[model samples]
Structures are given as structure tokens and as C-alpha cells.
Target chain A: MELLLFNIFNGFIIGIFYALMALGLSMILGLNGIINFSHGGFLALGAYMAYSLAPAIGFWGALIVSPFLAGFVGLIVERVLIRPLYGRDPLFSLLLTFGLAMIMQDLIRTFWGATGLPFEVPNALTHPLSQVYFFITGYRVFLVALALLATASLFALLKFTRVGIRIRAGNADLEMVSALGINIYRLRAVNFSLGIFMAGLAGVLAAGRLGLTPTMGASLIMPSFVAIIVGGVGSLVGSLLGGIIIGVAAGITTTYYPAASDVVIYLIMAVVLIVRPRGLMGQEGLLE
Target chain B: MKSAASRHVDAAKPADAMSSQKSTRRRVAASALVWALLLTAPYWLPLTGGYTDLGSRVLVFSLAALGLNLLLGFTGGLSFGHAAYFGLGAYGTGLMLKFVTHSTPLALLAGVALGGLGATLFGPVTVRRRGIYFAMITIAIGQMFYFVAVRWNSLTGGEDGLTGFERTNIHFGHAILNLHNSTIFYYFTLFFFAIGCAVVWSVLRSPLGHTFVAIRENQKRLRFLGVSVGFYLWIAFAISGFIAALAGALYALLNNFTSPEDLNWVLSGDFVIICVLGGMRTFWGPLVGSVIYVVVQDYLSSITVNWMSFIGAIFVLAVLFFPWGLLGFFQRRIQK
Candidate 1:
């Protein structure tokens, strides 16, 4: 029972990470129709930034600053590299981002050196919080609470904020949104930054948990993609649900058949594709 | 105006026919030149600081890219998971040699069947999705094979990779054809490459190939005509899988080793980029692209540790500047 609970909690944390990353990918994919292959790169960049800055500014300051810096980089990438390919085939953007992913990964290696680095968290959070639930460390609880807080704020931002509503509106009908005299180029740049910021946040959290490596984000990127797909491509809430579902599924699988853990998420995706081709919340005609 | 236009077209018919005849001759010459270059590569490659093995690698990758181009270029189906089949082919051949048989022909057959059958089975499921969703699903599906190869350590040898297999000599009647020699191996690879090329060429000429093209141009219109677009797509996907598997089998034979990396989505991206870099629409674009890509990669990796960045930059530049590819760009120039 303890092992099950432990795995479930672990899975829940991992699911939160997937949700955070998928939210960004889903946003860009929904708005631009371009799969940002470099989202993983941005993720690693954020973590690396936090790693580099943590010693100087301490963990809290680095956490607050690193994602924004990553977001700024994303903004620049959007304005320069991504903007020109907007009206072109989605294939071009895919290629462009794929290339960007490679370049970013290489750059991370070049700049930070090609070795895994440890990210140190505060000492207070490392201790177990309860004797009954030895797995419930203070850091784990803090991490979960932070993730929940971020997810809620993001939901609130989307629901109540002006830019968030415009983003949602643009996703529904770009032409209609454009006709209303909004600068979609700027909107996209902001949206890309917003999505990347989530990736950045995920990266920081991931680094604290998984340790920092050049290829750290690569493993998480796929699950996030799966999460978005299973949750329904255009639905943010669905991405959240999908992430948690796959994570919990993986957690449960790990206890009985450890080797199948990595593959079970993909199996779920295949089943979802077969049973619900449009996904749980995918819009009609979206597949076409 | 219509009658005048018709009269002008009728008057220009002879000239148009003459140019077409000239073009046909030029095409034949170009094809002959290409074949001659390939056949004589072993002789000239050493002079250019390249080896016969490099030539073989080009042929192997070209075959993979060509296969992928069938679905991607011809059928407009975006498959980002082709490396799954490619990797399966490699593993199949390796396992057959390691555990089952020593016969290369048998191994090749098994490899092709394994990989092709895998794709064939998954075709219907994947064909239901379109565009970027298609790409996402294919990639996800491809990862399943990758994880299996990684975790099934007892059989696949896990991350260290599968080894202890070598290509054996062939005997036809009384004479023995030695394959250990690099030049001999190049010829052997070329023989299979030629077979793959011929198969793709024949398929492109068939009515089904035309239908695939029509589907690419307008799926809705074809569906309106009551054609099952999904069925044709499955056929294209399966055939491409078969060819990619053949390439993967040859790759395993070349290295005498197989690893999980062969099945990774990164290789799939490389194959797709090779297709785009060469010119997806052109029949021989992948061949041209493969030559440039392989040579450039060879040179860059030799010179700098940062060759990945350079390769990435190449993708960016290719997409931004040369979206049509070398062959397509040249074709455009000729047309103009």
C-alpha cells in the first residue's frame, strides 16, 4: 500500500510536469499550427538558466527570473526565426523548429559543458514531513503545491485576462480575430512567450527533481506530446487531464511491470487514437 | 480569342513536340550519367579522399529517404515515425543472424517482412489522422518500438547495442562472391539499391501512383469520386515501410551491429529532412539530397564537435532559402 501510494504521488508530480510542458506546446500548436520542436530546448534552457543563476541569486530569485528570461528568448525567436514562416506550410515551421531544437541542444552543450549537473534545493524541503508517509518529503509537497498554484493561475489567466481571451478567441477563428484590428503577429509573439514560459517553469521543476542535463527535456517532450494528443489537441483542460492520466497509469505500471512503464503512455495514446480519433475534447473537423 | 488561342497552340505543337523529344533525350543522358557515376564510384572515390564505404552509406540512406518520400512527397502523408520500421528491419536482420540463420538472403527477407508487416498493421490506425496530428501520432507510435528495443535487454543487448553478427560470403553455383572486401560490399549494397530504385520507379508509373498524387493534390475531391483515400494511403505507407526496412537491413549488414538509435524519431527526422533537402517532389531528389547531406555530415563531423549545430543550421537554411531543393530548383530554372 505504501509503495502504491508512493508511486501515485510520484506519478502525480510527473503528471504535473507533463501538464505544464504540454500546456505550452498545446498553446503554440493551437494558435500557430506549428509544432515547436524546440520547446524542449527552451525547457532545458530554463533549467540551465536557473542552475547558473541559483548560486548568485539563490533558488527563489532564480526560479522567478529564469523562466522570464527564457520567455524573452522565446519572444526573440518568434519575432525573428518563426514569424516569416507563418503563412507558409506547417512543414516549414516543423523543419525550422526541429533545426532549432538541435541547435539549442548543441548550444546548451557548448555553453554549459556536456555533463550532467546537480541542482541543489533548500535544505528545509528535503526532510520527510510524516512518519506514516515517509515518501512525503517537504520538497515533494512544496513541488506539488507550486505546480498546482501555477496551473490554477494559468487557468485564471486564460479565463479572466484580456490577452488570454484574445488567444482563445484567435484559436477559434483567426480570420475573425484579425478582422477586429488585432495585430496577430504581436499576439503570436506573446502567445509563444507565454507557452515557452510554462516550459521554462517545467524545466526548473524538472531540474530540481531529475537533475540538469543537456538531454533532460527530450524525454519529457514526447509524453507532453502524448498528453496533448490524448487530452484533445486544442483543449488546455484536456491536456491537464491527459497528463495526469498517463502519469498515474505509468505509476501503476511501474509497481507491477517496471519495464513497461515508459511504453504504457504510448499504448494509451494508440488506444485513444483508435477509440476516439478526435481525442477527448478535440474540436470537430480538427483532424481534417 | 478562344479560336485564335487554339490556332496558335496548333501552330506551336511541332515546336513543343521537338522540345519534348529533346528533353526525353536529355533525361536519358542524365540518367545514364548518374548510373555511370554510381557504378564507377569505387574507382574515383579514393581520389576524392572518400572511401567505398562512404559511397555505400550514401546509397543506404538514399534508399531510406526514397522510401519515406513515397508517402511524404507522393501521397502527402506526413510520417515522422518511419525510423520505427527502419530500426525493426535492422534488429530483425541482426537477430536472425545472431540466433536463427547465417544466410544473408534469409535475414534480408525476414527483416523486410518484420518491418513492413509492422507498418502494415499500424497503417489503418495512423491513416485516420491527417497533417500535423498524423505526424504527432506517428512519432508517438515510433517511440513504442524505441522503448521496447531499449528495455528488452536480454534479447536486444540494451543500450550497448547488438553485435557479434557479420555479413557472410555468397555462393552462386560453384563460384564464391566475397563480401568482406569493401569494393565487393559496395557492389552488393548497390545491387539492392538498384532494386529499391527500380521498385519506386515502377510504382510511380502505375495508376495507383497517379491516384496517390491526386490524393495529395485534393483528398476531398477524390473522396467525392467515391475513392477510399484511406486504403490508398495505407498501401503507400506499407510499401514505404517495406523499402525503408530493406534499407535498414542493408545498414545492419554494413555495420554488423544494431542499436535502439536506429529506430529513434531523430533518424526519422533526418530521413524527412533528406527528402526535403533534395526535393521531395522530384523522382531523384532524395538521391541528390542524400549525396550532399552525407558528404557534408561526413566533413562537418570530422572538423568540429559542434557539427549538430551546423546540421541544424542547414535545416533552417534549406527550409528558408531552398525550400524547393536542388533538383526542384534546377527544374524551375530550366522551365523558366
Candidate 2:
């Protein structure tokens, strides 16, 4: 029972991570019109940046600041490398970002070395809160709370803020938004960085749990794609739901059958696709 | 390149016979030159610090990219998960040879069947979506196979990869075709490559191929015309998957080894880049792409540990400046 509970909690946390990733990826796909293969790269950048900064500024500060720095890098990258491909075939962006992902991974490996780096958390958050549920470490609880806070803040911003409203408007109809004299390019750039910021945040959080490796982001990114897919493309809440659902499903499977855990996520996707082709919340023909 | 006969038929278009004749003559000449170079690869490769096996590897990639282009370049479906089928073919062949038979033909058949069957099964599910959605699902599906191969350690040899399989000589009663000879294997690979080219060429020129193109051009319009766009996409997906599998089988025969990397999404990306970088629209794009990509990779990996950076840079540059691809750019110039 403890093992099952432990696995379920672990899976739930992993699901939140997936939700973070899928939400960011879906944002870029919706507004920027590319799959952003380098989203994982940005994620790694965030984690690595946080790793380097933690010693100097302490863990909490690094956690708060690393995602913003990664977002800064994303802003420049979007302006220089990605801007040219706008109004062009999405294929070019796909190939371009795919290349960018490789470059980012290689660069990360070059700088950090290929070996895994451990991320330190606050000492206060290291101890388990309850002896009965030994797995509920303060760090895990903090992670869950922080993620919830970030997600809630994001939702609030999107609902209340003017820039957030414009981002949403642009996602719906870029031409209409542009006609309204809203600088769509700036809006897109902002949206891209916002998405990358979330990726960066996810990266830092993931680093704490999984440790930092060049391939960590790459491996996690695929499951995010799966999460978005199972949740439904063009649906944010769907991506979030899909992530939690798959993570929990995977968690449960590891209790009984371990080898089949990864494959089971995909199997669920196959079942979802068969039963609900538009996904849980995706509208028909949005992409077509 | 596409079969010479089809190119001839294409050149005979009524709009402008004179330019078409010129284009046809130039293309045929190019085809002849390419074939000649391929035929003499064994003789000249050693002089150029190359080998027959490298040439065979190029053909393997070309075949896979060519197969993928049937859906991506021609049919408008950007499938990023094709390596799943390719690796499946490789695993199937390797497994068959290791566990079942010394019969080379049987192994090859088993590989193609295994890989092709995967695409056939999954093609419909993907066909329901288009563009990046299709690409994402394909990637996820491909990863499923990758994970399975990794987790099924006892059967797949785990992360160390499957080995102990060897390609045997073909028996023609009195005369034995020794595939043990790298040169003979090259010819054997070329024979299959030629068949692949012919299949793609004929398909592209056929009514079915035309319908596939029509769907790519305008899915909604075709739907309005009462054509079953989804079914056609599935067909394209299946055929391309089979082609990629054939290439995978050849790849296994070339190395006598197979691993989960064969089915990786990274390799799938490489195949797609090969298609786009070589000119997705051109029949010979895959060939040209494989040549540049394989050769550059072969050279770079030997020299620098950061060869991935170089390859990534190449992809960026190609997308930015050479979007039309080398062949497509030249053809555009010729048309101008």
C-alpha cells in the first residue's frame, strides 16, 4: 500500500511536469505556428542555468530567476533565428527548430559535460513531513504547491491582463488582431518567451527531482507531445488534463507491471485516438 | 532518380514541348551520369577514400527518404515517426536471421513485412489529423516502439544492441552470389534500390499518386469533390512505411547489427531533413540529400566531437537559405 501510494504521488507530480511542458508547447503551436522542437532545449537551458546560479544566489533565488534568464535567451533566439521563417511554410520552422534542438543539446553537453549534475534543494524542504506517509517529503509538497501557484497565476494573468488577452486574441485570429493595431510580431515574441518561461520553470523543477542531464529534456519532451495529443491539440486545459491522467495511469502501471509503463502511456493515446479522435477538448478542423 | 520512362512522359507535356524536350534531355543525361557513377562506385570509391559499403549505406538512406517523401514531399503528410518502421524492419531482419534462419531472402522478407505491417496498422490513426498533429502522433508512436525495444531486453539484446546475425551468400544452384563480398552486396542493394525508385516513380505518375498529390494541394477541395482523402493518406502512409522498412532491412544487411537507435525519432528527423534538404519535390532529392548528409556526417563525426553542432548548423542554414533544396534551386534556375 505504501509502495502504491508512493508511486501514485510520484506519478501525480510527473503529470504536473508534463502539463507544464504540454501547456507551453501548445501555446507556441497555437500562436507561433510551429511545434518548437527546441522547447526541450530551452528547458535544459533553464535547468542548467539554475544549476550554475544556485551556489552563488542560493536555491530559492536560482529557482525564481533561471526561468527568466532562459526566457531572455528564448527572446533573442526568436528574434534572430526564428523570425525569418514566419509567413513561410511551417515545414521550414519544423526543420529549423529540430536543428535548434540538436544545437542546444550539443551546446549544453559541451558546457556542462555529458555527466549528470545533481540539483540541491533547500535543507528545510528535505525532511518528510509525516512518518506514516514517508514519501511525502517537504520538497515534494513544496514542488506541488509551487507548481499550483505558478499555474494559477498564469491563468489569472491570462484572464485579467491586457497582454495576456492580446496573446489569446492573437491565437484565435492573428489577422484580426493585427488589424486591431496590436503588433502581432511583438505579441508572438512575447507569447513565445512566455511559453519558454514555463518550459524553463518546468526544467528547474524537473532538475530538482530527476537531476540534470542533456538528454533529460529530450526524453521528457516526447511525453509532453503525447500529453498534448491525448489531451487534444489546440486545447490548453486538455493538455493539462491529459498530462495528469497519463502520469497517474503510468504510476498505477508501475505498481503491477514495470516494463510496460512507458508503452502504456502511448497505448492510452492510441485508445484515446480511437475513441475520441478530436481529443478530449480539441475542436475539429482547427489544424486542417 | 525516378524511372527514366516516367520523366520522359512528364517532359512530353503539351504546354511547351520545346522546353520540355530540353528538360527531358538534360534530366536523362543527368540520370545516365548518376547511374554510371553508381555502377563504378566500387572501382572509384577506394581511390576517393570511400568504400562500397558507404555507397550502399547512402542507397539505404536514399531509399528510406524516398519512401518518406511519398507521404511528406508528395502526399503532404509530414510524418516524423518513420524511423519506427525502418527500425522495425531492421529488428525483424536481425531477429529472423539470429533466431530462425540462415536464409538471407527469408530474413529480408520478414523484415519488410514486420516494418510495413506497423505502418499499415497505425497509418489510419494518424491520417485523421494533419500537419504538426500528424507529425507529433507519429513521433509519439515511434517512441513507443523505441521504448519497447529498450525494455524488452531479453529478446532485443537491450541497450547493447542485437548482434550475432550475418548476411549469407545467395545460392543460384551452380553459382553462389557471395554477399560476403562488399561489392556484390552493393550491387544487390542497388538492385533493390532501383526497384524502389521504379515503384515510387510509377506510383507518382499513376492515378493513385495523382490523387495523393491532389489531397496535398487542397484537402478540403478534394473532400468537396467526394474523394476519400483520409483513405488515400492511409495508402500513402502504408506504401512509404514499406519503403522505409525495405531500406531498414538493407541497412541491417549492410551492418549485420540492429538497435533501438534504428527506430529512434532522431533518425526519423534525419530522414525528413534529408528529404527537405535535397528538395522534397524532386524525384532524386533523397539521393542527393543522402549523399551530402551521409558524406558530411561520415567526415564530421571522424574529426570533431561536436559534429552534432555542425549538423545542426547545416540544418539551420539549409532551412534559411536553401529552402528550395540544391536540386530544386538548380531546376528553378533552369526554368527561369
Candidate 3:
């Protein structure tokens, strides 16, 4: 029973991480119509930035600041590198982002060293919350709470804010939005930054749990893609649900058959593709 | 280089009978020149600081990229999981040589069948999606194979990769074709490359190829005309898989080993980039792209450890500035 509970809790937490990453990737895909392969790089950058800043700004401060730095870099990249191919084939953007991913990974390795580094958390958050369920540390609880808060606020922002409404509207019909005289170029820049900010946040949280490595983002990114696919592209809530479900599935499988865990997520994706091609919450004809 | 110059002339010249005749003559001459260069590469490559092995590598990449372009450029199907088929071919050949049979012909046949059959099975499930979705699903599916290769340690050799595979010499009656010679192997690889090119060329000139191109131009129009677009796309996908597998099989023979990296999404990206970097629309684009990419990579990796970043930079620059590629750029110039 303890093992099951432990695995479930672990899976839930892993799911949240996948959801966080998928949400950012989904946003970029939604607004830009470009699969931002470099989103993984941004995630790593945020984590690495936090690692570097933790000494100077402290852990809490670095966690707060690193995402913003990542967002700023994302904005520059969108403007200078990504903006040109906005009207052309999405293939160009995919290739560009892929290249960016390679460069980002290599640069991170160059700066932070190739080996994994330990990300120190506050001592207060290190202790086990309960004797029976020692797997639930204070840090784990804190991480989950922060993720939930971030997710709730993001939903709220998309629902209520003026920029959020415009983003949603633009996603529905870019031509119609442009017909209304909205500056889509600026909107895309803001939207890209917003997506990158989420990725950066995920990075910081992920680093706290998984440690920091140059290729850490690459390993996690594919699962997030699976999360997005299962959640249904263009549906944020679906992305969340998809992430958690796959995480839990993977977590449970690790108990009995560890070799099959990775393959299980892909199996789920294949089944989902066969059963619900548009995903759980995907809109028909959005990407077709 | 000769082909590029003559293509320029072909574009510049009028479409009159006299000019058309000149264009045909120029094309035949260019093709002859290319064959001559390939035939003598072993002798001359050493002078240019290259070897027969490097030449074979370029041809292998060219074959892979050419196969990808059949779906990507000709048929308007953007598949990013071709590495699955390529890797299947590699592993099939390696396994055959390792445990099944020592006969090279039988091994190549098995490799091609393994990869081709895999594609045939997966192609139907994917044909429904278009554009980026298609690319995404293909990638996800490809990774499934990759995971299997990694986890199935006994059969696949796991992370260390499958070794103990070598190409065997062929015997026809009393004559022996010893592939131990690097030059002989280069010619051996070239023989397959020629067959692949001939297949692609013939397909492009056929009615089915026209239908594929029509789908690329506008699928809705073809659908209205009562064409089963999905079926045709599946055919193109399968054919490309066969060609890609053929290339992978040759690659395995060249290295005497196969690994999971051959099936990874990164290699799929490399194939796609090769297509775009040469000229996706042009028949000879893969050759041009493969030559430049392989030679540059050879030189770069020799000099610096930061070659990956440099290659990445090239991708960014290629997308931004040279989107039309070398041949496409020249064609555009001539037209203008």
C-alpha cells in the first residue's frame, strides 16, 4: 500500500511537470503555428540560470528571476530569428527551432559543464512530512503547490486579462484579428515570451527535483510532446490532463515492469491517435 | 558544377525546338560528366584530401535524403520518422550477418524487407494527418522503435549497439568480387545508388508520380477529381521507406555495425535538412546537399569539438538566407 501510494504521489508530481512543459509548448504551437523545438532549450536555460543566480540572489530569488530572463531571451529570439518565417511554411520554423535547440544545449554544456550539478534547496524543505510516507518531502509539497498556483494563475490570466483575451481571439482566427487592426506581430512576440516564461518556470522546478544537466531538457521534452498530443493540441486543459495521466501511468508501470515504462507512454499515444485523433480536447480541423 | 551551369543555360534559353534540343544535349552531357566524376573519384579524391570511404558516405546520405524527398518534396507529405525505416534496415542487415546468414545478397534483401514492411504497416495509421501533425505523429511512432531497440538488449545489443557484422565477398561462377577493397566497396555502394536514382527518376516520370505532385499542389482538387489521395500518399510513403532502408542497409555494411542512433529523430531531422539545404524541388538536390553537408561535417569535426553548434548555425542560416538552396537559387537567378 505504501509503495502504491508513493508511486501515485510521485506520478502526480511528475504529471504536473509534464503538464507545465506541455502547456508552454502548446501555447507556442497555438499562437505561432510553429512547433517550438527550442522550448526544451528554454526550459534548460531557465534551470541553469537559476543554478547560476542561486548563489547571488538566493534560491527563492533565483526561482522568481530566472523565468523572466528566459522570457526576455525568448522575445529577442522571436523578433530576430523567428519573425521572418511567420508567413511562410511552418517547416522553416521547425528547422530553425531545432537548430536553436542544438545551439542552446551546446552553449549550456559550455557554460555549466557537461556533468550534472546538484541544485540545493532550502533546508526547511528537505525533511520528510510523515514517517509512513517518507517520500513526500517538504520540498516536494512546496514544488507541487507552486506548480498548482502557477497553473491556476495562468488559466486566470488567459480568462481575464486583456492580452489573454486577444491571444485567445488571435488563435481562433488570425486573419479576422488582423482584419480588426490588431498588431499580431507584437501579440506573437508577447505570446512567445509568455510560453518561454512557463518553460523557464518548469525548468526551475524540475531542476529542484531532477538536478541540472545540459541534456536533461531533451529527455523530458519528448514526454511533454506526448502529453500535448494525448491532451489534444490547442487545448490547455487537455494538455494538463494528458500530462498527469501519462505520468501516473508511467509511475505505476515502473513498479512492476520498469523496462516497459517509456514505451507505455508511446503506446498510449498510438492508442489515442487511433481512437481520438484530435486528442481529448482538441478542436477538429485546427491543425488538419 | 557543370550541371549547375547548364541548368542555368536551360532556364535562360527559349522553349523553342532549337533551344529544347540544346537543353537535352546539355542535360545528357552533364549526366555523363557526373558519372565520369564518380567513376574516377577513387583515383582523384586523394589529391583533394578525401578518400573513397568519404565518397561512399556522401552517396549513402544522398540516397537517404533522396528517399525522404520522394515523400516530402514530390508528394507533399512531410514525414520526420524515416529514420525508423533506415534503422530497421541497418539492424536487419547487421542481425543477418551476425546470426542468420553470411551471404551479402540475402542480408541486403532481409534488411530492405524489414524496414519496408515496417513502413507499410505504419503508413496507413499516419496518412490521415497532414502537415506538422503528420510530422509529429511520425516522430512519436519512430521513437517507439528507438525505445524498443534500446530496451531489447539481447536482440539489439542495447546501448553498446550491435556489432560483429561484416560484408562478405560475392562470388559469381568463377569470378570473385572482394569487397574488402575500399574502392570496390565504393563502387558497390554506387551501384545501389544508381538503382535508387533510376527508381526515383522512373517514378517521377510516371502517371502515379503526376498524381502525387497534384496532391502536393492541391489535395482538394485531386479529391474532387475522384482520386484517393490517402492511398497514393501511402504508396509514396512505402516506396520512400524501401529506398531509405536500402540506404541504411548499405550504411550498416559500410560501418559493419548498427545502433539505435540511426533511428533517432535527430537523424530524421538531418535527412529533412539535407532535402531543404540542396533544393527540395530539384531531382539532384539531395546529391548537392549530401556532398556539401558530408564534406563540411568531415572537415569541421576534424578541427573542432564545437562542430554541432556550427552545424546548428548552418541550419538557422540556411532557413533564413538560403531557403531556395544552391540549385534553386541558381534556377531563380536564371528565371529572373
Q: How many residue pairs clash in each candidate?
A: 0, 0, 0
Candidate 2 residue-wise lDDT, B1-336, digit = tens: 112112322212435878777778888999899889888889999998987889999999999999999998888888999999999999999999999999999999999999999999999999998877888889999999999999999999977789999999989999999999999999999998999999999999899999987777677789999999999999999999999999999999999999899999999999999998888878899999999999999999999999999999988999999986888777776665
- Look at candidate 1 and give me any clashing residue pairs: none
Question: Docking category for candidate 3?
Answer: medium
Over B1-336, each residue of candidate 1 has an lDDT whose tens digit, in order, gives 112112212111224777778766877897899899999999999999999999999999999999999998878888999999999999999999989999888998899999999999999989987888888888999999999999999999988889999888888999888988899999999999899999998998899998987777778889999999999999999999999999999999999999999999888989989999988877788899999999999999999999999999998999889977888787666655
Indicate the residue-level lDDT of B214 in model 1: 73
DockQ of each: 0.50, 0.57, 0.50
**Residue-wise lDDT of candidate 2 within A191-257, one digit each (tens)?**
8899999999999999998899998889889889989999998889899899999998999889999
lDDT per residue (tens digit) for residues A77-97 in model 1: 998899888766666788889
Could you say which candidate leads in lDDT?
A: 2
Determine the iRMS, in angstroms, of model 2: 5.6
What is candidate 1's CA lDDT for residue B206?
Answer: 95
User: Candidate 1: lDDT of B326?
Assistant: 89
lDDT of 2: 0.90
On DockQ, the leading prediction is 2
**Against the true structure, whose TM-score is highest?**
2
Error of 3 at B286 (Å): 0.6
Per DockQ, what order, best first? 2, 1, 3
Q: Across residues B252-316, which tens digit of lDDT does each residue of candidate 3 receive?
A: 99999999999998888888889989988777788889999899989999999788898899889
C-alpha lDDT (0 to 100) for residue A154 of candidate 1: 83
How far out, in Å, is residue A241 in model 1?
Answer: 1.2
